[model samples]
Target: MLYGLIICTITVIIMSTVNIGLEFGKLDTEVFLIILKSFPIILIIAMLLEVLVIGRIAEKLVHTFSDNTDGFNAKILFTIFFTVIGMSLIMTVIGGMLGKGISPDSFGSLSHWPRNFSIALFCELLIAQPPARFVMKKLHLRQEDKLDYDFD
Candidate 1:
Protein backbone atom coordinates (compact mmCIF):
# COMPACT_ATOMS: atom_id res chain seq x y z
CA MET A 1 0.00 0.00 0.00
CA LEU A 2 2.74 2.43 0.91
CA TYR A 3 4.61 1.47 -2.23
CA GLY A 4 1.55 2.05 -4.34
CA LEU A 5 1.09 5.51 -2.82
CA ILE A 6 4.68 6.42 -3.47
CA ILE A 7 4.46 5.25 -7.02
CA CYS A 8 1.24 7.14 -7.63
CA THR A 9 2.72 10.33 -6.18
CA ILE A 10 5.82 9.94 -8.28
CA THR A 11 3.75 9.34 -11.37
CA VAL A 12 1.80 12.55 -10.75
CA ILE A 13 4.99 14.53 -10.36
CA ILE A 14 6.46 13.05 -13.49
CA MET A 15 3.32 13.87 -15.40
CA SER A 16 3.39 17.44 -14.15
CA THR A 17 7.01 17.82 -15.10
CA VAL A 18 6.40 16.47 -18.58
CA ASN A 19 3.74 19.11 -19.07
CA ILE A 20 6.00 21.92 -17.92
CA GLY A 21 7.08 23.25 -21.30
CA LEU A 22 4.44 21.96 -23.65
CA GLU A 23 1.44 23.97 -22.58
CA PHE A 24 0.83 27.36 -21.05
CA GLY A 25 -1.02 28.25 -17.84
CA LYS A 26 -4.63 28.26 -18.96
CA LEU A 27 -4.29 25.24 -21.15
CA ASP A 28 -2.41 23.43 -18.44
CA THR A 29 -5.13 24.16 -15.93
CA GLU A 30 -7.83 23.05 -18.29
CA VAL A 31 -6.13 19.87 -19.28
CA PHE A 32 -5.15 19.04 -15.75
CA LEU A 33 -8.71 19.59 -14.63
CA ILE A 34 -9.96 17.44 -17.40
CA ILE A 35 -7.49 14.72 -16.47
CA LEU A 36 -8.48 14.85 -12.85
CA LYS A 37 -12.18 14.94 -13.43
CA SER A 38 -12.23 12.44 -16.21
CA PHE A 39 -9.83 9.96 -14.67
CA PRO A 40 -12.62 7.58 -13.71
CA ILE A 41 -13.79 7.65 -17.27
CA ILE A 42 -10.34 6.77 -18.49
CA LEU A 43 -10.05 3.97 -15.98
CA ILE A 44 -13.43 2.61 -16.95
CA ILE A 45 -12.47 2.72 -20.57
CA ALA A 46 -9.27 0.83 -19.85
CA MET A 47 -11.16 -1.77 -17.85
CA LEU A 48 -13.60 -2.27 -20.64
CA LEU A 49 -10.78 -2.57 -23.09
CA GLU A 50 -9.25 -5.28 -20.96
CA VAL A 51 -12.50 -7.22 -20.82
CA LEU A 52 -14.11 -6.47 -24.14
CA VAL A 53 -11.02 -6.07 -26.26
CA ILE A 54 -7.94 -7.77 -24.85
CA GLY A 55 -9.71 -10.56 -22.99
CA ARG A 56 -11.74 -11.75 -25.94
CA ILE A 57 -8.84 -11.43 -28.29
CA ALA A 58 -6.53 -13.31 -25.95
CA GLU A 59 -9.11 -16.06 -25.54
CA LYS A 60 -9.22 -16.56 -29.27
CA LEU A 61 -5.46 -16.59 -29.70
CA VAL A 62 -4.71 -18.70 -26.65
CA HIS A 63 -6.74 -21.59 -27.99
CA THR A 64 -4.03 -22.28 -30.53
CA PHE A 65 -1.66 -23.43 -27.83
CA SER A 66 -1.36 -27.16 -27.31
CA ASP A 67 -0.61 -28.46 -23.84
CA ASN A 68 2.31 -30.27 -25.42
CA THR A 69 3.44 -27.06 -27.06
CA ASP A 70 2.58 -23.62 -25.75
CA GLY A 71 1.52 -23.73 -22.13
CA PHE A 72 1.02 -21.37 -19.24
CA ASN A 73 4.30 -19.50 -19.55
CA ALA A 74 4.02 -19.15 -23.27
CA LYS A 75 0.48 -17.86 -23.12
CA ILE A 76 1.41 -15.35 -20.46
CA LEU A 77 4.24 -14.08 -22.61
CA PHE A 78 2.07 -13.74 -25.67
CA THR A 79 -0.72 -12.06 -23.71
CA ILE A 80 1.68 -9.52 -22.28
CA PHE A 81 3.19 -8.88 -25.66
CA PHE A 82 -0.12 -8.48 -27.39
CA THR A 83 -1.72 -6.49 -24.60
CA VAL A 84 1.03 -3.95 -24.03
CA ILE A 85 2.33 -3.40 -27.53
CA GLY A 86 -1.00 -3.69 -29.25
CA MET A 87 -3.00 -1.55 -26.83
CA SER A 88 -0.29 1.06 -26.43
CA LEU A 89 0.08 1.43 -30.16
CA ILE A 90 -3.66 1.72 -30.56
CA MET A 91 -3.83 4.37 -27.84
CA THR A 92 -0.92 6.26 -29.35
CA VAL A 93 -2.61 6.50 -32.70
CA ILE A 94 -5.81 7.65 -31.06
CA GLY A 95 -3.96 10.22 -28.99
CA GLY A 96 -2.17 11.50 -32.04
CA MET A 97 -5.43 11.93 -33.84
CA LEU A 98 -7.00 13.73 -30.90
CA GLY A 99 -3.93 15.94 -30.69
CA LYS A 100 -4.41 17.18 -34.22
CA GLY A 101 -7.40 19.50 -33.95
CA ILE A 102 -7.20 20.90 -30.47
CA SER A 103 -4.20 22.36 -28.74
CA PRO A 104 -4.86 22.30 -25.04
CA ASP A 105 -2.49 24.51 -23.10
CA SER A 106 -1.63 21.43 -21.13
CA PHE A 107 -1.85 19.16 -24.13
CA GLY A 108 1.86 18.66 -23.72
CA SER A 109 1.07 16.44 -20.78
CA LEU A 110 0.07 13.80 -23.26
CA SER A 111 3.72 12.85 -23.37
CA HIS A 112 2.84 10.74 -20.37
CA TRP A 113 0.20 8.75 -22.20
CA PRO A 114 2.55 5.99 -23.15
CA ARG A 115 3.94 5.84 -19.66
CA ASN A 116 0.50 5.80 -18.15
CA PHE A 117 -0.62 3.28 -20.66
CA SER A 118 2.36 1.11 -19.77
CA ILE A 119 1.48 1.30 -16.12
CA ALA A 120 -2.10 0.37 -16.85
CA LEU A 121 -0.91 -2.44 -19.05
CA PHE A 122 1.22 -3.73 -16.20
CA CYS A 123 -1.72 -3.67 -13.86
CA GLU A 124 -3.71 -5.52 -16.46
CA LEU A 125 -0.88 -8.03 -16.73
CA LEU A 126 -1.05 -8.76 -13.04
CA ILE A 127 -4.77 -9.31 -13.16
CA ALA A 128 -4.37 -11.53 -16.19
CA GLN A 129 -2.72 -14.47 -14.48
CA PRO A 130 -5.90 -15.89 -12.99
CA PRO A 131 -7.62 -15.99 -16.34
CA ALA A 132 -4.47 -17.39 -17.83
CA ARG A 133 -4.55 -20.21 -15.32
CA PHE A 134 -8.14 -20.93 -16.16
CA VAL A 135 -7.34 -21.13 -19.81
CA MET A 136 -4.24 -23.22 -19.24
CA LYS A 137 -6.17 -25.62 -17.05
CA LYS A 138 -8.85 -25.96 -19.65
CA LEU A 139 -6.13 -26.80 -22.11
CA HIS A 140 -4.98 -29.60 -19.74
CA LEU A 141 -1.72 -28.01 -18.72
CA ARG A 142 -0.15 -30.12 -15.99
CA GLN A 143 1.26 -28.98 -12.67
CA GLU A 144 4.58 -30.75 -13.23
CA ASP A 145 5.48 -28.50 -16.12
CA LYS A 146 4.73 -25.29 -14.26
CA LEU A 147 7.61 -22.89 -13.97
CA ASP A 148 8.92 -22.49 -10.47
CA TYR A 149 8.44 -18.89 -9.43
CA ASP A 150 11.63 -18.50 -7.48
CA PHE A 151 12.21 -15.05 -6.03
CA ASP A 152 15.87 -15.78 -5.49
Candidate 2:
Protein backbone atom coordinates (compact mmCIF):
# COMPACT_ATOMS: atom_id res chain seq x y z
CA MET A 1 0.00 0.00 0.00
CA LEU A 2 2.82 2.42 0.82
CA TYR A 3 4.60 1.75 -2.43
CA GLY A 4 1.39 1.94 -4.42
CA LEU A 5 0.28 5.12 -2.75
CA ILE A 6 3.60 6.85 -3.24
CA ILE A 7 3.91 5.77 -6.84
CA CYS A 8 0.35 6.80 -7.64
CA THR A 9 0.68 10.16 -5.94
CA ILE A 10 3.77 11.14 -7.90
CA THR A 11 2.49 9.70 -11.16
CA VAL A 12 -0.89 11.37 -10.89
CA ILE A 13 0.45 14.76 -9.92
CA ILE A 14 3.08 15.02 -12.64
CA MET A 15 0.90 13.41 -15.29
CA SER A 16 -2.06 15.61 -14.43
CA THR A 17 0.03 18.76 -14.56
CA VAL A 18 1.57 17.94 -17.93
CA ASN A 19 -1.73 16.77 -19.38
CA ILE A 20 -3.57 19.86 -18.25
CA GLY A 21 -0.82 22.06 -19.68
CA LEU A 22 -1.09 20.30 -23.00
CA GLU A 23 -4.88 20.50 -23.08
CA PHE A 24 -5.19 24.09 -21.99
CA GLY A 25 -2.04 25.35 -23.75
CA LYS A 26 -1.39 27.34 -20.61
CA LEU A 27 -1.05 26.76 -16.92
CA ASP A 28 -3.02 29.38 -15.09
CA THR A 29 -4.92 29.26 -11.84
CA GLU A 30 -7.93 27.98 -13.75
CA VAL A 31 -5.92 25.19 -15.38
CA PHE A 32 -4.39 24.26 -12.05
CA LEU A 33 -7.86 24.11 -10.55
CA ILE A 34 -8.97 21.90 -13.39
CA ILE A 35 -6.04 19.58 -12.73
CA LEU A 36 -6.94 19.42 -9.05
CA LYS A 37 -10.59 18.75 -9.83
CA SER A 38 -9.73 15.95 -12.23
CA PHE A 39 -7.05 14.40 -10.03
CA PRO A 40 -9.04 12.15 -7.71
CA ILE A 41 -10.77 10.09 -10.35
CA ILE A 42 -7.60 9.68 -12.37
CA LEU A 43 -5.64 8.69 -9.29
CA ILE A 44 -8.23 6.08 -8.33
CA ILE A 45 -8.29 4.65 -11.83
CA ALA A 46 -4.48 4.56 -11.99
CA MET A 47 -4.26 2.80 -8.63
CA LEU A 48 -6.81 0.17 -9.58
CA LEU A 49 -5.12 -0.42 -12.92
CA GLU A 50 -1.68 -0.61 -11.30
CA VAL A 51 -2.77 -3.26 -8.85
CA LEU A 52 -5.17 -5.28 -10.99
CA VAL A 53 -3.41 -5.09 -14.32
CA ILE A 54 0.02 -3.43 -14.54
CA GLY A 55 1.53 -4.82 -11.35
CA ARG A 56 0.89 -8.43 -12.25
CA ILE A 57 2.06 -7.99 -15.81
CA ALA A 58 5.24 -6.19 -14.76
CA GLU A 59 6.07 -8.91 -12.24
CA LYS A 60 5.74 -11.55 -14.89
CA LEU A 61 7.90 -9.59 -17.29
CA VAL A 62 10.55 -9.04 -14.64
CA HIS A 63 10.65 -12.73 -13.83
CA THR A 64 10.83 -13.64 -17.50
CA PHE A 65 13.59 -11.16 -18.31
CA SER A 66 15.65 -11.19 -15.13
CA ASP A 67 18.01 -14.00 -14.23
CA ASN A 68 18.89 -15.20 -10.74
CA THR A 69 22.27 -13.59 -11.27
CA ASP A 70 20.69 -10.23 -11.99
CA GLY A 71 21.24 -7.59 -9.36
CA PHE A 72 18.37 -6.00 -7.42
CA ASN A 73 18.68 -2.91 -9.59
CA ALA A 74 18.29 -4.98 -12.76
CA LYS A 75 15.04 -6.50 -11.57
CA ILE A 76 13.79 -3.17 -10.36
CA LEU A 77 14.65 -1.53 -13.65
CA PHE A 78 12.78 -4.18 -15.56
CA THR A 79 9.75 -3.87 -13.32
CA ILE A 80 9.75 -0.08 -13.61
CA PHE A 81 10.11 -0.25 -17.38
CA PHE A 82 7.26 -2.70 -17.82
CA THR A 83 5.02 -0.95 -15.32
CA VAL A 84 5.52 2.46 -16.93
CA ILE A 85 4.84 1.08 -20.40
CA GLY A 86 1.63 -0.65 -19.33
CA MET A 87 0.34 2.27 -17.27
CA SER A 88 1.14 4.87 -19.91
CA LEU A 89 -0.47 2.91 -22.73
CA ILE A 90 -3.67 2.30 -20.80
CA MET A 91 -3.88 5.69 -19.13
CA THR A 92 -3.38 7.68 -22.32
CA VAL A 93 -6.65 6.39 -23.72
CA ILE A 94 -8.46 6.59 -20.40
CA GLY A 95 -7.29 10.16 -19.84
CA GLY A 96 -8.43 11.18 -23.26
CA MET A 97 -11.84 9.70 -22.63
CA LEU A 98 -12.05 11.36 -19.25
CA GLY A 99 -11.13 14.72 -20.70
CA LYS A 100 -13.13 14.57 -23.91
CA GLY A 101 -15.85 12.10 -23.01
CA ILE A 102 -17.26 9.54 -25.43
CA SER A 103 -16.59 11.19 -28.72
CA PRO A 104 -14.32 11.16 -31.77
CA ASP A 105 -11.61 12.99 -29.83
CA SER A 106 -11.58 10.32 -27.19
CA PHE A 107 -11.49 7.63 -29.82
CA GLY A 108 -8.67 9.44 -31.57
CA SER A 109 -6.67 9.61 -28.34
CA LEU A 110 -4.29 6.87 -29.40
CA SER A 111 -2.41 9.40 -31.48
CA HIS A 112 -1.22 11.01 -28.29
CA TRP A 113 0.09 7.78 -26.81
CA PRO A 114 3.66 8.21 -27.98
CA ARG A 115 4.07 11.55 -26.27
CA ASN A 116 2.22 10.42 -23.17
CA PHE A 117 4.22 7.22 -22.98
CA SER A 118 7.49 9.11 -23.20
CA ILE A 119 6.53 11.49 -20.42
CA ALA A 120 5.23 8.73 -18.18
CA LEU A 121 8.22 6.52 -18.78
CA PHE A 122 10.65 9.32 -18.05
CA CYS A 123 8.90 10.41 -14.89
CA GLU A 124 8.34 6.91 -13.53
CA LEU A 125 11.96 5.95 -14.06
CA LEU A 126 13.72 9.14 -12.97
CA ILE A 127 11.14 10.73 -10.67
CA ALA A 128 8.55 8.47 -9.07
CA GLN A 129 9.97 5.00 -8.43
CA PRO A 130 13.28 6.03 -6.89
CA PRO A 131 11.63 8.05 -4.15
CA ALA A 132 8.92 5.43 -3.61
CA ARG A 133 11.45 2.61 -3.37
CA PHE A 134 13.66 4.66 -1.08
CA VAL A 135 10.75 5.34 1.24
CA MET A 136 9.77 1.67 1.17
CA LYS A 137 13.30 0.63 2.00
CA LYS A 138 13.45 3.06 4.88
CA LEU A 139 10.12 1.86 6.26
CA HIS A 140 11.13 -1.76 5.83
CA LEU A 141 14.34 -1.14 7.73
CA ARG A 142 12.51 0.75 10.43
CA GLN A 143 9.98 -2.06 10.81
CA GLU A 144 12.78 -4.61 11.02
CA ASP A 145 14.46 -2.53 13.70
CA LYS A 146 11.29 -2.70 15.75
CA LEU A 147 10.89 -6.46 15.38
CA ASP A 148 11.34 -8.56 18.55
CA TYR A 149 14.41 -10.72 18.23
CA ASP A 150 13.40 -13.38 20.76
CA PHE A 151 15.48 -16.20 19.37
CA ASP A 152 16.61 -18.16 22.36
Candidate 3:
Protein backbone atom coordinates (compact mmCIF):
# COMPACT_ATOMS: atom_id res chain seq x y z
CA MET A 1 0.00 0.00 0.00
CA LEU A 2 2.83 2.39 0.81
CA TYR A 3 4.50 1.59 -2.49
CA GLY A 4 1.26 2.10 -4.39
CA LEU A 5 0.71 5.48 -2.75
CA ILE A 6 4.27 6.60 -3.49
CA ILE A 7 3.94 5.61 -7.14
CA CYS A 8 0.60 7.42 -7.44
CA THR A 9 2.04 10.56 -5.84
CA ILE A 10 5.07 10.50 -8.11
CA THR A 11 2.92 9.99 -11.18
CA VAL A 12 0.63 12.89 -10.22
CA ILE A 13 3.56 15.19 -9.55
CA ILE A 14 5.22 14.34 -12.85
CA MET A 15 2.00 14.72 -14.78
CA SER A 16 1.25 18.02 -13.08
CA THR A 17 4.70 19.40 -13.90
CA VAL A 18 4.42 18.27 -17.50
CA ASN A 19 0.98 19.82 -17.82
CA ILE A 20 2.16 23.14 -16.38
CA GLY A 21 5.11 23.22 -18.76
CA LEU A 22 3.27 22.12 -21.89
CA GLU A 23 -0.10 23.76 -21.35
CA PHE A 24 -0.75 26.94 -19.42
CA GLY A 25 -1.29 26.96 -15.64
CA LYS A 26 -4.99 27.67 -16.09
CA LEU A 27 -5.63 24.65 -18.30
CA ASP A 28 -3.43 22.41 -16.18
CA THR A 29 -5.15 23.48 -12.98
CA GLU A 30 -8.55 22.94 -14.45
CA VAL A 31 -7.75 19.44 -15.64
CA PHE A 32 -6.10 18.55 -12.33
CA LEU A 33 -9.10 19.76 -10.35
CA ILE A 34 -11.46 17.82 -12.56
CA ILE A 35 -9.40 14.66 -12.05
CA LEU A 36 -9.35 15.20 -8.29
CA LYS A 37 -13.10 15.71 -8.22
CA SER A 38 -13.80 12.59 -10.26
CA PHE A 39 -11.38 10.37 -8.32
CA PRO A 40 -13.60 10.13 -5.24
CA ILE A 41 -16.58 9.11 -7.32
CA ILE A 42 -14.54 6.44 -9.08
CA LEU A 43 -13.26 5.09 -5.77
CA ILE A 44 -16.70 5.06 -4.18
CA ILE A 45 -18.24 3.24 -7.11
CA ALA A 46 -15.48 0.63 -7.10
CA MET A 47 -15.75 0.09 -3.35
CA LEU A 48 -19.51 -0.17 -3.39
CA LEU A 49 -19.47 -2.67 -6.23
CA GLU A 50 -16.85 -4.76 -4.53
CA VAL A 51 -18.70 -4.80 -1.23
CA LEU A 52 -22.14 -5.42 -2.67
CA VAL A 53 -21.39 -7.80 -5.51
CA ILE A 54 -17.92 -9.27 -5.40
CA GLY A 55 -17.73 -9.76 -1.66
CA ARG A 56 -21.12 -11.35 -1.36
CA ILE A 57 -20.64 -13.71 -4.30
CA ALA A 58 -17.20 -14.81 -3.21
CA GLU A 59 -18.33 -15.34 0.35
CA LYS A 60 -21.34 -17.41 -0.69
CA LEU A 61 -19.32 -19.57 -3.05
CA VAL A 62 -16.61 -20.24 -0.53
CA HIS A 63 -19.03 -21.14 2.22
CA THR A 64 -21.19 -23.25 -0.06
CA PHE A 65 -18.21 -25.37 -1.08
CA SER A 66 -16.50 -25.50 2.33
CA ASP A 67 -15.32 -28.85 3.67
CA ASN A 68 -17.43 -28.97 6.77
CA THR A 69 -18.27 -32.69 6.90
CA ASP A 70 -16.23 -34.41 4.22
CA GLY A 71 -12.54 -33.58 3.79
CA PHE A 72 -12.56 -31.94 0.37
CA ASN A 73 -11.03 -28.51 0.97
CA ALA A 74 -8.94 -28.70 -2.19
CA LYS A 75 -12.03 -28.69 -4.38
CA ILE A 76 -13.22 -25.43 -2.86
CA LEU A 77 -9.90 -23.66 -3.27
CA PHE A 78 -9.48 -25.00 -6.79
CA THR A 79 -12.84 -23.52 -7.71
CA ILE A 80 -11.87 -20.20 -6.15
CA PHE A 81 -8.65 -19.88 -8.13
CA PHE A 82 -10.30 -20.80 -11.40
CA THR A 83 -13.11 -18.36 -10.69
CA VAL A 84 -10.60 -15.59 -10.02
CA ILE A 85 -8.68 -16.25 -13.23
CA GLY A 86 -11.87 -16.46 -15.28
CA MET A 87 -13.16 -13.21 -13.80
CA SER A 88 -9.83 -11.47 -14.39
CA LEU A 89 -9.85 -12.44 -18.04
CA ILE A 90 -13.41 -11.26 -18.50
CA MET A 91 -12.76 -7.97 -16.74
CA THR A 92 -9.65 -7.34 -18.80
CA VAL A 93 -11.60 -7.72 -22.01
CA ILE A 94 -14.54 -5.63 -20.81
CA GLY A 95 -12.26 -2.89 -19.48
CA GLY A 96 -10.54 -2.86 -22.84
CA MET A 97 -13.87 -1.90 -24.37
CA LEU A 98 -14.90 1.11 -22.24
CA GLY A 99 -15.24 4.51 -23.96
CA LYS A 100 -13.80 3.35 -27.27
CA GLY A 101 -12.70 0.00 -28.57
CA ILE A 102 -9.21 -0.94 -27.56
CA SER A 103 -6.52 -0.04 -30.04
CA PRO A 104 -4.96 -3.27 -31.28
CA ASP A 105 -1.40 -2.02 -31.01
CA SER A 106 -1.81 -0.65 -27.52
CA PHE A 107 -3.77 -3.67 -26.35
CA GLY A 108 -1.07 -5.99 -27.66
CA SER A 109 1.49 -4.22 -25.49
CA LEU A 110 -0.76 -4.14 -22.40
CA SER A 111 -2.16 -7.69 -22.45
CA HIS A 112 -2.41 -9.72 -19.22
CA TRP A 113 0.35 -12.27 -19.72
CA PRO A 114 2.88 -10.54 -17.48
CA ARG A 115 0.38 -10.23 -14.66
CA ASN A 116 -0.70 -13.88 -14.99
CA PHE A 117 2.92 -14.96 -14.99
CA SER A 118 3.66 -13.09 -11.78
CA ILE A 119 0.59 -14.52 -10.06
CA ALA A 120 1.56 -18.02 -11.18
CA LEU A 121 5.06 -17.56 -9.85
CA PHE A 122 3.82 -16.29 -6.52
CA CYS A 123 1.41 -19.19 -6.13
CA GLU A 124 4.05 -21.75 -7.09
CA LEU A 125 6.56 -20.35 -4.64
CA LEU A 126 4.25 -19.74 -1.71
CA ILE A 127 1.41 -22.25 -1.96
CA ALA A 128 2.52 -25.24 -3.98
CA GLN A 129 1.77 -28.37 -1.92
CA PRO A 130 3.98 -29.42 0.98
CA PRO A 131 5.68 -26.03 1.22
CA ALA A 132 2.35 -24.38 1.85
CA ARG A 133 1.25 -26.95 4.41
CA PHE A 134 4.56 -26.54 6.17
CA VAL A 135 4.23 -22.77 6.22
CA MET A 136 0.74 -23.00 7.59
CA LYS A 137 1.87 -25.30 10.38
CA LYS A 138 4.57 -22.81 11.26
CA LEU A 139 2.04 -20.04 11.39
CA HIS A 140 -0.32 -22.16 13.51
CA LEU A 141 -3.11 -21.82 10.96
CA ARG A 142 -5.50 -24.35 9.47
CA GLN A 143 -5.95 -24.98 5.76
CA GLU A 144 -9.43 -23.47 5.70
CA ASP A 145 -8.28 -20.29 7.37
CA LYS A 146 -5.35 -20.18 4.96
CA LEU A 147 -7.83 -19.34 2.21
CA ASP A 148 -8.16 -15.93 3.82
CA TYR A 149 -4.45 -15.41 3.37
CA ASP A 150 -4.82 -15.98 -0.36
CA PHE A 151 -6.77 -12.74 -0.64
CA ASP A 152 -4.17 -10.90 1.39
Off by over 4 Å in 3: 1-45, 69-83, 86-90, 99-152
TM-scores, one per candidate: 0.43, 0.91, 0.32
Best-matching candidate per TM-score: 2
Task: Report how far residue 98 has shifted in candidate 1, in Å.
Answer: 5.3
Which residue pairs in candidate 1 have backbone atoms (N, alpha carbon, C) closer than 3 angstroms, thus clashing? 27-105, 27-106
Better structure of 1 and 3 per TM-score: 1
Q: For model 1, how many clashes?
A: 2
Candidates 1 and 2 compared by lDDT, better number:
2
Residue-level lDDT tens digits of model 2 in 62-94? 999989999998998898889988998889889
**lDDT ranking of the models:** 2, 1, 3
Model 1 ranges with Cα > 4 A deviation: 1-34, 65-68, 97-152
lDDT over C-alpha atoms for residue 32 of model 1: 68
Clashes (backbone N, CA, C under 3 Å), per candidate, total 2, 0, 0
